[model samples]
Target chain A: MPLLDLRGVTKDYKLGKTVVHALRGLDLRIEKGEIVAIMGPSGSGKSTLMHILGCLDVPTSGEASIEESQISSLSEKQLVELRGHKIGFVFQTFNLMQTLSAQQNVELPMIFQGMKKKERAQRATELLTMVGLADRVNHRPNELSGGERQRVAIARALANDPEILFADEPTGNLDSESGGTILELLKRLSTEYGKTVIIVTHDPDAAAIAERIIHLHDGRVVEEVKNA
Target chain B: MLKDFFMLAARSITHRRMRSWLTVIGVFIGITAVVALISVGLGLNKTVEQQVAGVFGVDTFVLVPKGSFGPQRHAGGSSDQYALDLEFLKSIPGVKVAAAVRQRTGFVQGPTKADGTSTQGFLPVMGLSTELVNEFESFTGKLTVQPGGRLFLPEDKDVAVLGADTAERLEAKVGDTLLIAGDANKELNLTVVGIMAPNDEEASTGSSGGFSAGMQPAQSKDTIYVPYDTMSLLWGEASDVLVTLVRTQPGADVDEVADRVEKELNARGSEVSSITYSDISDAIGTMTTTVSAFLAGIAGIALLVGAVGVMNTMFTSVLERTKEIGVMKAVGARNSHILTIFLIESGLMGFVGGVVGTLAGLGLSALASMFIGRFFGVQMAVVASPALILITLAGSFLLGAFAGLWPAWRASKLPVVDALRYE
Candidate 1:
């Protein structure tokens, strides 16, 4: 069975008196240890799809399963547990807590997962070291460079040893050199560590690193590219 | 979870240190006033009780004439100004010593010697039996003659004791002769045999009330102490004389004795008014308690104002921590957890305020007691006790908790999404 499955998924929103359909009867499947790139222009429902995949937003209709457990029907608390224990997200803005050190930020997910402080710190250090941010453990977000901040975000995404890592335009806020480094890191996550990595990006260069790419236009998948 | 709540609380306080201090101060002032007022009131209550016990002595049934509510306005009222008769005193059973006292005014000459500096001062003359001396001594110990001789004995009917001021004014000593006169111009020669000290300078100068050996402005300077029989003989049965002082055995209830005395006196052909020590003490007690409560209630107004200040500070704190509240909620903090944290923070502020206010009140009361007592000649002591302090602290914390309720509820109800999006 696929790690993440979606069948006939539909998401609708009410903006005042007007109705906007964010997702319209979408069907998709992603297996374990697979690196997939979702490419779409702005307002193509790609962000909404990412939100559903990451368990941050619920679908209005349809079934989504993560690890064969029905994700769409889970309670909010259950969803939080699923998010904390099974999924990690990397936002484009590097949404790190400003008041917390980089190390504390990385350990946040494990803390939510109810790990002991010592164990959480141990895991956080290893992940930070993996992302080449070991020396910046104590630095707050304000003290870090853009690339370093994204790296910290990447380390945080792996804090609880999640089965899937979701990166939403992870290099969108970085310079070309920093962006290249982040793409390399994501590629390494899928190729070397065997994490189910999903990247949503508009940049063709960023998408090139993925083994499979799905192109979306106007809230629907238009084509698929395989780079075997 | 508790740890997280504690850390959140600590951070909340640190981030808004000034508002926290302001809230604390508000609660502190309220607690201090409540405690200080209660303590001082208790002290005054204790003092008055002690004074009444001392003044009334063991068991005494005093007969005072009742005042009239009539049109006439007089010091003793228009109650048929009659004194206790000597016949009734000699008749009553279980009655030990019945001394009839006759009050009159006279003057003393300030040492008219061979050099001649004749200064005349007025004094009050209390003419009574030798037995009545015991009653006078018990009421005001200064009523005793300190030196140069003794009080009037039954045999020494023509001898008198001089108050210190009376003696100083007249420059008279033992064996000195002074002429004693009455309201009816009845005059007699008396020898000054003893001198007594005044209760205090203020009491001596007639500036305050309470018993004093010195002559008051209303009394005679040429004060005389003669035997009751001598006065009876000098001015026969026509002059009214029924007021008598009666002393009971120790531990006897003075109220019962006074009631019995009143019945006996009324049965013997004369109206009676019995003045028990309990009457005066009760009056003073009621008056003191009323005044203390009134002043305390007024002080409570200031405390209410302080509570308002605390409420305002708490509201500001809630507003400033909106973003933080959002973050906590997003991290899975329940609504009750958020409420408890705010309550604890507010209560802690109130508790600290209460402690500081209590200390401030104690210091102020002590300073006032020391300085004001010396200047005003009234004894004022601030009595701070542990029970009172604890009550004040608890009361302040309650006030703080009450103040935080609305703010805390508002904070906890804020939507997590909106709060996270807050600036």
Candidate 2:
């Protein structure tokens, strides 16, 4: 069975007297150890699809399964657990808390998991070391390079050792050198760690690193290609 | 969890250092006012009660010739025929000591006076038994003869012992001659026997300048004491009104004795009127309560206003941290966490305010007490009762919690996504 499955998913928003169809009749399947990049322009409903799959929002109709557990049928509490324990998220803006140091930011998700402080600290240190940010652990987000901040956000996403990693515009806020370094880390995270990684991006250069690429326009998949 | 909460609270307060300090000051004034004013009031009430109790010690009841409704009301129309006779005093059971006091108001004539060194007007002269002097001294336990001799002896009919200032005014000393004169056939050529030491209230007020200098004038300076027998002999039936004083046995219920004395005096004749020690004390208590209520009402209003200030601050905090609230909620914090954090913050503000206010109050009360002791001839101190302090702290805590309620609720009910989107 696929690690994740979505069948005829639809999301609708009511804006006063009008209705906005954010996602309509979408079907997708993702297997373990696959690196897929979802490429789209703005207003193509890709973000809505990503939000639904992350369990941050539910689809208006249809079914979603993560690790064979039907996520759309779960309660709000169960949805939280699914998001907390199984899926990790990275945002384009490098959503690192400004007040916290890089190491503290990484340890935040583990805090939600009720891990002991000593254990959480040990793991957070290890992950920052893995992301080439061992020396920047004590530095706040503003004190770090753009690539370094995104690395901290990635470390935060991995704090629970999630089964699937989701990156939204993973290299959008970086120069070529930093952006290339982040894409290399993503490739390593999928290939070496054997984790399923999905990235949503508009840059073809960034998408070229993915094992498989799905092109989307106007809320529908337009083309698919395999990376050489 | 507790540590985390405390650290968060301390850090947050420190982050807004100026605001925190200003809040602390506001709360401090409120706390101090409550503690100091109430305490001083308590202390003054205690001192007044103590003075009154000392002035008329245990087991003693006073009798006025004409009946009056309250102790404050002085009786009218002195009747010479209805005076308390010595025989009637000796007849009452359980009355170990008794005296009938006859007061006459007069002034001392200056001898060879200089200009501006006028004859001082004296406090009313109460002619009583030699035993009455002993009773007063024993009750107060501090009265001493400061200069040149003892009180008048019963047989020494033409002698008088002047108060300290009265002796200076009349220019008389022990064995020095003075004409003790009053109106309507009351006059005596008496020798000054002794000058008593100044009382506590008198000594404090004398150096503090008279009434014009925000100080009460000394009541002791113009007082004189002479034997009841001596006054009667000198005046020759001119002094007729009697103020009788009686004391019951130790451990005996005073009210019972008072009732018994009243019954006995009434049985002898309706002309004898008695006032128990309880009556004057009760009247004094009522007056103190009324005064305290008036004063505390103003302080309470100040505290209420402080609470309003706290509410305003909390409302501003809620508006300022709206985005933070959303982030916390999105991070999986429940509504209870949001509520608790804000409540704890407000309560902490109150607690700090309470501490500072308590200190401020103490300082204010001390100043007040000094002024009272200096001028009013009444000793007042800033009282620090544990109950009062606790009440003050609790009041601030309640005010903090009460003020934070709406803000906390507003924070808790914020939609997570909208809050995250708020600037």
Candidate 3:
């Protein structure tokens, strides 16, 4: 069974009197250990799709399932549980809490999972070390570089040992040099960790690092390209 | 989970240091007002109790003509019309001794002669039987005499005893001769046989410049004492007893005695009422409680205003952290977690305010008591129990939590997608 499966998913938002179709009849499947990119221009519903897959939102109609559990059928409380344990999300802004240290940011998801303090601290240190930030564990977001911030966010995403990881425009706020390093780190996550990684980006260079690229236009998949 | 939330809230409050401090100050002002005002009021109640205990002995009751207990009515009456049946009062089982007292206001010429003119002032003149004078001395446990003077004898007609304050004001020693102008312009020259000790009890009950309409000034420090025969000589045959003092036997119920006296007076068709010392004490207690509650209520308004300030600050905090709330939600925080975090933050603000305010209030009460003691000559004791402090702290904390409920709920209910998109 695929790690993530979606069949005829649709999302609609009401903008005053008019209905805005953010997604329409979207179908996708992602298996374990696969790196895929959903590439689209602005307003093509890339973020809406990421939100639905991450369990931050539910589709208006149709089916979305993670492993054997139907996402659309889960209650809000169950969704929160699934999101905390089964999935991880990294945003374009690197959303590290400014007041927390890199180590604390990484330990946040584990804290929600009711992990003991000593164990979560140990896990956070290991994760930050894996992200090449061993020396910067105690540094807050403001004290870190753009790439370091994103790395802290990625470490936080991996805190619960999630089965799948989602990155939404992960390199949008970084320089080209730091952006290259981030893409390389994401590729290593899929290859060495055997985790299903999904990246939603409009930049072709960021999409090139993924093994599969699904092109979306007007909220629909128009092309599929297989890279090495 | 609660610990984590507390840590998060603490971090948030510390991040915005200035706003948090200002909010705390607002609550501090309110709590301080409540603590200080109520404590001072309680102190005043204690002072009044002490004064009443001193002036009217615990076992002594007063019998006055009906409606004459009121100071305004007492001033309007002809003393000749109000007379207590001393023999009948003494006939009661619990009545140990009964003494009829005649009180009148008169002008006494002082020993000081300014340009050959004697200084005179209005002073209270009390006419008492020698037996009653001895009872008063025994009740007070102190002899009413100056350093080198003696109390007047029952048959002494031309000798007088002056209160310490009156002696000081009149510049009259124990051997000096003073002139007194009594009712109907009757004049008498009497030798001062003794000078009484200064009465601190009178200062507490005397006119201190507030609303004292229905209350009459008790026998104060500025008074002179004479035998009943001497008073009769000055006022002629119309001198009637003004009030009667009844002493209850040791260990007897004063309330029962007072009730029996009232019943007997009513049975004999006498328009007189008897009041026990406990009755006066009870009235004073009720009045003090009411005044304290009223003052506390006014202070509570300030606390309510402080609560509003806390709510406003929490609402602004929620608005500013919209994006952060979205991030937390996306990272798997439940609505309850968000609610707990914000509530903890606001509640901590209130708890801290309570602690600081209680301390500040105690300090302010001490300062006020010092001022009162210096100016009014009455020592006030401020009361602050640990239980009261704990209640105030808990109450302030609950107030903050209540104030933050709506804002925290709003933050928790915000749509994740829209919140992330907020600037």
Candidate 4:
């Protein structure tokens, strides 16, 4: 079964008396363990698609499902549980809680999962070590470099061990060297763990890491490119 | 989950130390005022009860004129011509001894050394029987005879007992002679047989009420007490009964006897009233409660203002952390979790405020007591028990939680998508 599927999904944004169509009947599917990138310029509805696929939002029409559970059919509480346990996201800004240390940030999703301290601690420590931030576990986001902070966010994203991970402009705030390292981490995550990875960005270098790139325009999939 | 939320709340509060402490200050000031006033009120209540109980014995029934409270009032011709006949009072059921205490302004002169003419100091003189004086020493007003002196027997003539201050002013030791002259200079030489030891616990309040206080200040200190026979001689001013003390038999129903005494005195055309120690104590208790409640009400107003201050701070905190709230929701925090975290934060603020206020209030009460003792010569006691502190802490915490409810609810209801996008 596909890891993520969106059929005839439409999302609309209302501004005063105007209804802004953010997405228009977008049909998409990604197989399990695949790396896909959705690329588009501003106002191309790529951001809205990212939100729907990440479970942070639902489509106004049509079915968006993760692991066979329909997003639009879930209650608020069910939605909360589904996203908390099955979906993970990385942002362009790192979005690490400034007050939390590296380890605490990683443990946050597991906390919502109702995992005990000892269990989540062990997993969080292992994830941080995997991201090469074991020594920086006690440092807050402000104390870490851009690359290190992003590494912590990646570790946090994997804390729940979701089947798929979504990156929204993941390397937008980092220098090229740091950005390359983050891309390397995402590649390692999918290749070794057999997890599906999706990247939403306008960065060609970022899309280059994906097996396939889906280009969106005016809320529709306009072109597709396969990476060799 | 609760533990996690509490830790989160703690971290958030500690992050903005100055603002949290300022919010706590608002709550603590109200708590301090309330605690200090309660402490002082309790102490004053203790002192007043002890004084009233000492002067009016539980087993004794006392009578003053109708419409008057103290025994020393309305002394002209003695309770409307019936004169509180001691023999008649002793005839009542359950009566052990009944005696009338007569107080009059007397001219007192220290030993004149054979004819050396000394100035006279007008002081109040009270007369009671020797047996009644002995009973009074044990039950009423904590009166005691100092050493090197003795109470006068019925056969003993021209003998008197001096209160502590009276003895000091007269400079008369036991056995020294003083001339006590009544109205029209009708004088007699009296030997000081005994001196009363000072009553230290209640020096000023209850002791002054029933000793012809209206005619002259009824002080336990400067009053001279003589036998009933000596007072009857004017000394000789027509047997005016100031007050009557009626002691009931041991274990007898004193209230019943008190009712009978009042009825007998009033039934034969004498206007008299009976009073017990409980009545006086209850009256003082009511006055203290009213005053304490009034002052506490003002403090409660300040506390209400403090609660509003807490709400204001929480609202600001929720607004400032809007983006943080978004991030938290993105990480899988449920609305309930967010709500609980904010509530805990505000409740912790209030609890801390209560704790600090209780300590500061105790300190303030102690300082106040010291000043009152030094400047006003009144020893003000303070009572701050552990239970009171605990109650205050809990109350303040609840106030904080209640104040934070709306803000916390707003924080919890923020949209996850918009919150993540919030700056």
lDDT of 1 by residue, A18-96 (tens): 9888788888889898889999888888888887887766888989888877877887667667776777778787777
Candidate 1 residue A178 C-alpha distance from true site, Å: 5.2
Better candidate number, 1 or 2, judged by TM-score:
2
Candidate 2 wrong stretches, greater than 4 Å: A1-5, A14-17, A30-36, A64-87, A110-116, A184-198, A205-228, B18-131, B138-149, B152-320, B350-358, B364-379, B384-398
Q: Alpha-carbon error at B305 in model 1, in Å?
A: 5.9
Question: What's the CA RMSD for each of the models?
Answer: 7.6, 7.2, 6.6, 6.1
* DockQ score of the complex predicted as candidate 1: 0.12
In model 2 chain A, which range of ten residues has the least summed lDDT?
A107-116
Enumerate the candidates' DockQ scores in order.
Answer: 0.12, 0.18, 0.58, 0.48
DockQ winner between candidates 1 and 2: 2
- Which ranking of candidates, highest TM-score first? 4, 3, 2, 1
Worst 10 residues of 3 chain B by lDDT: B209-218
Ranking by DockQ: 3, 4, 2, 1
TM-score of chain B of 3: 0.70
Query: Per-residue lDDT of B1-423 in model 3, one digit per residue for the tens?
Result: 688788888888889999998998888889999988878887788778776676667788877676565444566543333555556668988999886666777888877565676668888787766766576543233434657887768679977788777888888898888888876878899899988766455533443422211112233457787876677777764235666678899998989988898888768765666767677778788889899999999999999988998899999999999999988887788888888889988998888788899999989999999998899787888778777788889988988888899999999998888888888
lDDT of 2 by residue, B306-388 (tens): 76767777788778777767545544445666777677777778888988888778778888889887997667756778887
Task: Please state the error at residue A205 of candidate 2 in Å.
Answer: 4.6
Per-residue alpha-carbon lDDT of candidate 2 for residues A30-80, written as tens digits (9 for 90 to 100): 889899898878877777777777776777888878877787778766766
Model 4 C-alpha lDDT per residue in residues A71-165, reported as the tens digit of each score: 88988788788678777888898888777899999998888778899999999999999999989999999999999999999999889998778
